[model samples]
Target: MSHAFDLALCALILGAAVLAVTGRNVFGAIVFYVVYGVLLALAWLILGAVDVALAEAAIGAGVTGVLLIGAWQGLADAGGLEDEAPRPVFLRLAAVAGAGALGGLIALAVISLPGGDGLTLAVVDNQDRLELGNPVNAVLLGFRAYDTLLETLVLTAALAAVWSLTRTRVWGGVPGPGHVTRPDGVMASFGRLLPPAGLLVAVYLVWVGADAPGGAFQAGTVLAAVWILIVLSGLQDEPRLNSLPLRLMIIAGPAVFLGAGLAGAAAGAVMGYPDGHAKSVILVIEYALTLSIAATLALLIAGPARRAP
Candidate 1:
């Protein structure tokens, strides 16, 4: 049964991918892409990668779908949603050949790879040192802390790049378009009711991440989604990039992580936790990261500054 289910899912995923790529309308393509992400998340779950599933569902499906929808809406508003010139038949054929070749190469690579425990045993053996119940969390926040730190920095840098695209007159201004909502609308009601529940879920995910599949990235995505809903429903206005509190929230994660690394250096190695305090230090970093990541992702989806500060 499981094998049959897996085969069916693979078929669905392939169909969704094809539709996402070839759909005539941008909106339809975005919707199909979201379906592809959701199916991909399910595939990850079936492969016993719950952490990857969570990240896929949150970032790939949820956040990316919202971002694409926003972009499509913007294009529509600007009268840029009209169909573009079609590619020449030869160019289209070349693209198909290139895509097929790439797919074949990927399949070959996967087939040639040796399958083994591959880091699981090593991570389990060293998990005690990090005091994290979740081996994935231990690897992310402990053994591979530098990589995670770099990823956070990359997200911040991406936000900086987005801000750089702002007009000179609107530099350091508010991010995202102004939203006005009818007070009695479903969106307004959802904006009022959902955030409180979302906040609890976000906090719980971050707190439980030390021992489970949940983590900073998934929790941060949820938090960002809630904020986006609030802004979109007109429950709150987008914050100016120059706002002191907003700026602090955006940098809190990286700043704290860097500080922890420096403090770790004083203990003999960078990003090293002091003996008997690994969990405590990691939790602190996770909380800070959750805040920063949430803010950064929300702003990224919101796009560059528009209104004046």
Candidate 2:
């Protein structure tokens, strides 16, 4: 039964991917891409990686879908969404051939690989050192803290790149355009109703991350979605990019993380925590990361400044 279910799931995922790649309409492609992400998340769950499933669903499907739709809307507003000339037949054929070759290579690699819990046992044996109940969190926040810190910085850098595209006249202004809707509309009603629940879920995800399959990325994505919804429904406008408090929130995570890493010199490593305080330090970093990640993601989807302050 499980095998049959897996086959069906794989079919659905493949179908979605094909539609997303080949669909002519921009909106249709985005919808199929989101479906692909959700199906991929289910595949991760089937592999027993609940944390990965959550991250994939929240970030890959939810957040990315929003980002793509936002971009679509922007293009429409700017008159850039009109249908364009189709590619040449030769060019189309070359793209399909190249994609097929890459897919074949990946399949060969996966089939040739020998699997035996590559580092699972090693991580389990040393999990006690980090004092984290979640092995994935232990690896991310402890064993490979530097990589995680860099990941946060990458998001910040991406945001900076997006902001750099803003017109000079709109510098220091609000990201994205102003949004307004009827107060009694469905969107506005959802804006009012959903945020409280989203806030609770985001908090719960972060708090339980220490011992369970939840974490900063998932929680932050949810929070960002809530904020995006509020903005879209016209309940609130995006804050100006030049706001000091907003800038501080954006840097809070990386600043706190870097400070903690520097303090780790006392423990003989750059990101090490002092004796008996690993969990405390990790929690602090996670909370700070949650705040920065939420703010960064929300701003990212809001896009570059488009209005004067």
lDDT of each: 0.93, 0.92
Candidate 2, residue 91: Cα displacement in angstroms equals 2.7
Model 2 over residues 222-245: C-alpha lDDT tens digits? 999899999999999999999999
In the range 75-192, model 1's lDDT, one tens digit per residue, is 9999888755566889989999999999999999977777887778899999998889999999999999999999999999999998889999988899887999999999999999
> What RMSD, rounded to one decimal, does every model reach?
1.8, 1.9
TM-score of each: 0.93, 0.93
Best by lDDT: 1
Residue 107, candidate 2: C-alpha displacement in angstroms: 5.0
Clashes of each: 0, 0
- Model 2, residue 213: C-alpha shift (Å): 0.4
Q: Kindly report which residue stretches of model 1 are placed more than 4 angstroms away from their true locations once superposed.
A: 93-115
